[model samples]
Target: MQNRSLRADDWAAEALRKYSDMVYRLAYAQVRNRTDADDIFQEVFIRLVKSSPEFESDEHMKAWLIRVTVNCSKTMWLSSWKKRMVFWEDKDLNRIPAEEAPAGNEALEEALDSLPVKMRRVIHLFYYEEMSVDEIAEALSEKPSTIRSQLTRARKLLRKKLIGEEAKRRVQG
Candidate 1:
């Protein structure tokens, strides 16, 4: 019994260390606020601890965590108190290595902010997380075709928004 308990504890620690950043990033992507993302992060892990469900594999566990994070994000977003609040910060994207960031990173971020939440989530999972459409679909419990369409629409919206931003800048200058 003691050995089984220790093994479970070790598994939880390992899982946390392996997936915390991914969980946090997914949360941040959904909510677009540091504080809300942190809250979602804590809530996701708390749910994980409370449920203690057995996973068939690592991929299954990851998908489970992502689904929970997305659900929690939606709940938080829909909360009455959250609707009345405005919290904005760009720190999460700043974690991208300078060399990896595009020359117009700020413009890209602004464009992303303008996208609908579903589009933003799909885009972030595809581009930032380097997930394929099928993987994103699995994680989000969405269809691959749906994920593909969302990615296509997101790219078009981003291009339109970025171009508008550039046009505005040129007019100002």
Candidate 2:
């Protein structure tokens, strides 16, 4: 029993090491705040330890983490404490970490940040995490068609925001 416990502990640590960045990034993408994202990140791994779920494979584990992260973000948003707290429209609080963002991507990042949270999640999963529409739907508990529609709408919004509609039309023409 002791040996099993130790093995589980080790496995949990390894999983944290392997998936921490992905978890944090996903959380940050959803919450749009570093502090809340950090809280979500910790909550996710704590749940993992508490549940001690056995995954069939790495992909299964990744999927589980994504689902949990999304759920946690939702819970955070719905929490009474979150509801009561007021946030100032502070640009610094909402900007992505400089190191994580690539050079000349600030405009794009700003455009992404302007998106609604739901659109941001789909965009992050599809573009950053490279998850398929079906996978994002499964993780987000939405239908594939919904995920596809969100992705399409998100892209259009981003395009319109990043480059004016006139520029898009001129490019196409």
Candidate 3:
């Protein structure tokens, strides 16, 4: 498969064209910052270009990219662990503002960011990417049961947080 002679440049360009947003969104879901998301975005493609293993299918390609993006994001997070306090203080969304952000978007994003990395990744893939449970399990290299469990847990946590915030707001009012 490695001998199939895929040009790195061509592959890189195609990947960026077809999946750049997907890659960036995945990274953003992890690190929650533009600069680090961009870094992880670049690193995902770099690893794809330089790595020796050949992908078995487009699904394989997608899984590889997602896995690499997750790892690169984790690396950036660990390296910048000290910078996290600054992250909290900044209170900015990593994504470009959409034309219309639905109500509760910020609160939901905040809840998502508050989740553990594993749960965050699973929830992101399940909802943001609109991936099925099987697809998310493949991308995450986890069992379908694990993905389902993580999604359920994330839902419960987010519901609790949002409800708590609403109660606090009412109390203050």
Candidate 4:
């Protein structure tokens, strides 16, 4: 029994090490605030520790983490505490860590930040995480068609926003 418990602990530690960044990015993508994202990250790990649900495979474990992170972010988004708190200034647009972003990629980051949460999630999972549409749909609890549609819409919106921003800069310069 003790050995089994130790094995579980070891497995959890490995899981955290492997998936922490993915979970944090997913949380950040949803909430768009560093503080909220941090909270969601902690909550997701806490749930994982508490539940100790058996996963049939690594993919299943990943899907579970993504779903939990998303649900936690959604809960935080709709929380009364979150609703009541008001900060007048927008957070700095660079919530993503500097090291994670390539130099001269601010335009792309801004375009991504401009997207709606669902669009951002789909984009991140598909492009950044390199997950397939079906995998993303499974993780997000949406249909594959819905994931595809969101990806299409997100791309169009990004293109329009980026082009408009560039045009404005050109006119000003």
Candidate 5:
């Protein structure tokens, strides 16, 4: 809804107020740290304001935001990961961490943060959002087949990595 897009004066304030938690959480989920997530969140909104994207629908806006978050997360990690050696530096900065998270949630988040950027974004969008591959494709500006293929590959990778970790834990136990 173009009407929902922010006016010149209201753009930054409105976007930050409405989507800050969501964008921060999504970025943190990908990066798994406070500093990186905050950086990604800021970058995502900055890109939104600068680009002035005329979102086609709510879904379109969400997709674009997620896409930008994913990219910012990747850039943060790729360039500054070495500088950010501290563990979970941004824990206090998060606004949302799902108070009653499910079992093995931390492990899942650990595994998720280890995934490559593209695969992680797709998995997050699909599983967290309960979005279909076609819907994900529409959101990401990707083809349905590509989303399906990426999901398949991401699943296989997660299974392999998680299972291997489990097996290693059992062996150590």
Candidate 6:
């Protein structure tokens, strides 16, 4: 029993180390608050440790984490306490690493931030997670067509925002 427990601990630690950033980023993208994102991150790992679920592959595990994170975000939004509370907008919340951004463009990050939560999630999963439309649909519990439509709309909106920003800069310059 002691040996079993040690193995479990080691597995949990390895899982945390491997997936912490992905979980935190997804939670942060959904909640848009560091504290809440931290809470959701803990909650996700807690569920993983408690469940000790078997996975077919690393991809399966990643998909499971994405589903849990999305569900937790939804639950957070639905909670009465969350509904009543005022959100303090964190300016730096959307500042991802340079490599994550398109050419490390601040304008693209700002445009992504301006998107609705649903569209933003689709964009993040599709681009950052490199999930296919079917994978995103499965993880998000949406139809593939819906995911595709959201991707299309998000791309158009992003393009418009980026183009508009560029035109404004050119005019001012």
Model 3 vs. true fold: TM: 0.79
Which regions of candidate 4 deviate over 4 angstroms? Answer: 1-9, 83-86, 93-101
TM accuracy, model 4: 0.86
Top model by TM-score, which number? 4
Ranking, TM-score, top scorer first:
4, 2, 1, 6, 3, 5
State the lDDT of candidate 4 residue by residue for 24-105, as single tens digits.
Answer: 9888887776888889999999899899999999989999999999899888878867443665464554376778768977
- 65-95: candidate 5 lDDT, tens digit per residue: 8778877776787787453565566444443
lDDT of each: 0.83, 0.86, 0.79, 0.86, 0.75, 0.82
Worst 10 residues of 6 by lDDT: 1-10
Scored against the true structure, residue 127 in model 1 reaches a CA lDDT of 80
Q: How accurate is candidate 6 locally (lDDT)?
A: 0.82
> Tens digits of per-residue lDDT for model 2 on 1-173?
35444354488888998999999999989888787888899999999989989999998899999999999998888876744366666546546678877887776767877898899999999999999999999877899999999999999999988886457657989
What would the per-residue lDDT of candidate 3 be over residues 1-173, giving only the tens digit for each residue? 35544466566567767788989988878777687888988888878778845878777778788888888877887776554667564656555465455765777767877888888888789888899999888877789998999999999999998888788879999
Off by over 4 Å in 1: 1-9, 85-104
Provide the lowest-lDDT 10-residue window in model 5: 89-98
Tens digit of lDDT per residue, candidate 6, span 14-83?
A: 7788899999988877766577777889999999988999988887888889999988877877875754
User: How far is each candidate from the true structure, as Cα RMSD in Å?
Assistant: 4.1, 4.2, 4.0, 2.7, 5.3, 3.6
Task: Determine which window of 10 residues in candidate 1 has minimal summed lDDT.
Answer: 1-10
Model 2, TM vs. native: 0.82
- Kindly report which residue pairs in candidate 4 clash with one another: none
- Candidates 2 and 3 compared: the better one by lDDT is 2
lDDT for 26 in candidate 5 is 76
Candidate 4 residue 87 Cα shift, in angstroms, is: 2.2
